[model samples]
Target: MTDLDYRLEDFLSQVELEICEYLNKQKTKFPNSSKLLKRFTKRKDDWIHVSNHFRELKAKEKLGCKENSKSKEKTKLQDNIIIRNNELAEVVNELCIAKLFVEDITIDSIEYEPIVFKGDKSIDFHLRFIDGQTAYCDVKTIHPDDTGNWEQYQRALKNKLFPSHASFDLQQDSLGGILWHHSFASRTKMLEHVIEFEEKIVQKAINSSRKIMLFCGDGFRLSKDELEDFADFYYTEKYRKDDFMQLMEAYSMEKEAIILLRNIDYIAYFERKPMNLEYKFIPRVHGSASI
Candidate 1:
């Protein structure tokens, strides 16, 4: 599509297509990975509407059954599937947002993940802004697969994928986010992850001379009541408003939060300038929009 005719959905759809093709081609090597893509794409809408697999698993674990059955194994496998799919979803979401950033703040062309940076790491996107500033972008995700017997793959995930993906050495400036997608399995887990990240990661980025973005996960495709309920879960009982405030202090405006709709490959990025609480998702392309 021409630049004038291109939309966000088109970019996202292409990403989705690429992911599906990769999974399909690598099914023999990564059976669970390919199965996850197929399973989610087939019924993504239903999964989003009733996205409580984690809660259900917790409830089952609370039972503390000591039985060794195929059913139990199956349940555990499904849980792993949910985690992996959510993690992979973050990659597609990040790339789409990279395209958006290129269009928004950039003046020249941007390159995708390429191996020509510090530590020989592959920075996600490198672009030049309208004001002649360059940005080295990177997207990071933490998801360790559980069911896999592939020890090598797990090692690579921990060693190569996580540590080597940083965009530390900047040509001029930097732009990136530490994606907290599928890094945790529960609210308590999320709290722990957030604390560790804040203590170690957030401050360093804030102190950096370059711009950094933090994309926290908001994978819920909830109704109005559900969204409000979630807000209460965090702000009221969990005291997450303080965390939000701290995050604002660190990565405030250019301030972005992301959400995927109930169905389809579309993702919405909510942004606010100067980070003054006037946040909205800025009307991105929906599943039914013309591409």
Candidate 2:
């Protein structure tokens, strides 16, 4: 199977496990909780369908079929679109855990295509804090494979066309990769919206200023050279150096709030062996919490 196929399988397995755990907890709350139990039980059939579909896709991949060809691959890709949806669910879970919120929050709480400007669009989470204050949290997930793609994406952003990718689907399209290249622009727009949202949230924080917490995975930070490459790619002759400097300053100021919880760190926290990527850049903010 392709790497994408393997990732999809891993993601689905995790989702199934999470669903089972949720049902188990609910069962403990009410011994004869037929309502929730029955709902989950019904989902079992759907999960089976998903598994069978994946098995068929795997068989095709083994036979060396065209990755993005129509037929089983396309069908499988469409069927497995839920994988990305599940990833979004995971992001929401991580956000809640990191933010220490008791209430159930979800990706559905986020507004997509929030506003369309001349150059960009935005997606942001509207989170309600424990202290009755609402904060707009912008969550970003980066993969180890993002360095090169991110540079290309930053270029697409300048042209005002966002590249799209079918990361959730089985059929990998070059067009999608091209679209993925546009992510940098889209993300830049998202960040701009986040700044505005942060201002509003800060104003709403009754007792204190609103906090903008950027929960990033290991892929978020790169080596100094990689960062410089991305900066060079995104910045133009007029604003390249200045933009790069401003970004560094901003990063320095918000280093504390910008948590780089790497995958290895996560594995280590869970008592597993550290995986890879040894000499990475990990800057920690010291002193005050405010940026």
Candidate 3:
């Protein structure tokens, strides 16, 4: 075989190995490995092209070409794919933990993929918190770099129009309420999901006498504006003017109590260094908590 062909084969092998390693370490169960293998084999073709180019230059006695391409820029695409996959795996692990936590809190039927409103969408987990009350939980992964986008979502929630997503609909039903936990990462997309989730799902839960709690696993922070926005939004959307006034009166009469749980231990690893963490709680007007 030519040098280009040999090098192309080597690159394909490495890509396949890396993909398999990731799948195994993440403990993913694929319904059909053969199908996935074929899909990945097609993806490997892109890398093979790069490898072949490098090999061609080497055969031509180019000074810069070594076993791999000398240009660092060529690897950027591959590097990004690797980074994204790593982040996804970390997020999955955190979701597993959140799932376990939900199970611990309730003995009621713990259902995954619970059908809602005759659609393909389904809630991640639904728990019966108590007699005649159910808690719905949706797990989201956020990356810290996207805080600004999440801030926008918090604003949208106050306005009552949520950006569309399949999972959002499942939590919107008039029955059990929703609880959204940022499983891992703190990206804008995750924050957006939370905002839409609160407005579309959790608020519905609160309306039905169920409560909502937002769990930020670790290494994530929320600004004052974000918290205040959440509080104002929940109050306005969830309660009528008179009921809100009654709640304020009750808080004053009872000497308003705030339960703060700081730095609760949960499993998460920062994808970058020197990670800073923040958590804020916004109490809903009628004794519901938003964080």
CA lDDT of 160 in candidate 3?
Answer: 41
lDDT of each: 0.36, 0.36, 0.37
lDDT (Cα, tens digit) per residue for candidate 2, span 1-291 = 556556645654554455444434543222333433343345544555665666676677779875566365667665464654344433433322322322244211222222233443232334444456544444443322322364444443464332232112211244444334333333343244334444444344423423333333333232233233333322221213322233433344376464221111101000101121122222221212221
lDDT of 3 by residue, 1-291 (tens): 466456545644554464444443332222223333443445555445554554554555466444444455446544644454334333333333333433353433444434343343334445564475765555443334322234433343565433232112223232212212221123233334544445445333444523333333333342222333333334444322222122332343246453222111111222211121122222231223442
TM-score of 3: 0.35
lDDT of 1 by residue, 190-257 (tens): 33333433333333332322322223334332122222222333333321231212222223212443
Winner on TM-score between 1 and 2 is: 2
Best by lDDT: 3
So what's the TM-score on candidate 2? 0.35
For candidate 2, give the lDDT of residue 96.
28
Off by over 4 Å in 3: 1-79, 82-90, 93-96, 99-105, 115-122, 146-191, 198-217, 220-233, 236-291
How many residue pairs clash in all the candidates, one count each? 0, 7, 8
Error of 3 at 134 (Å): 1.2
**How close to the true structure is residue 243 of candidate 1, measured as C-alpha lDDT?**
25
For each candidate, give its TM-score against the true structure: 0.34, 0.35, 0.35
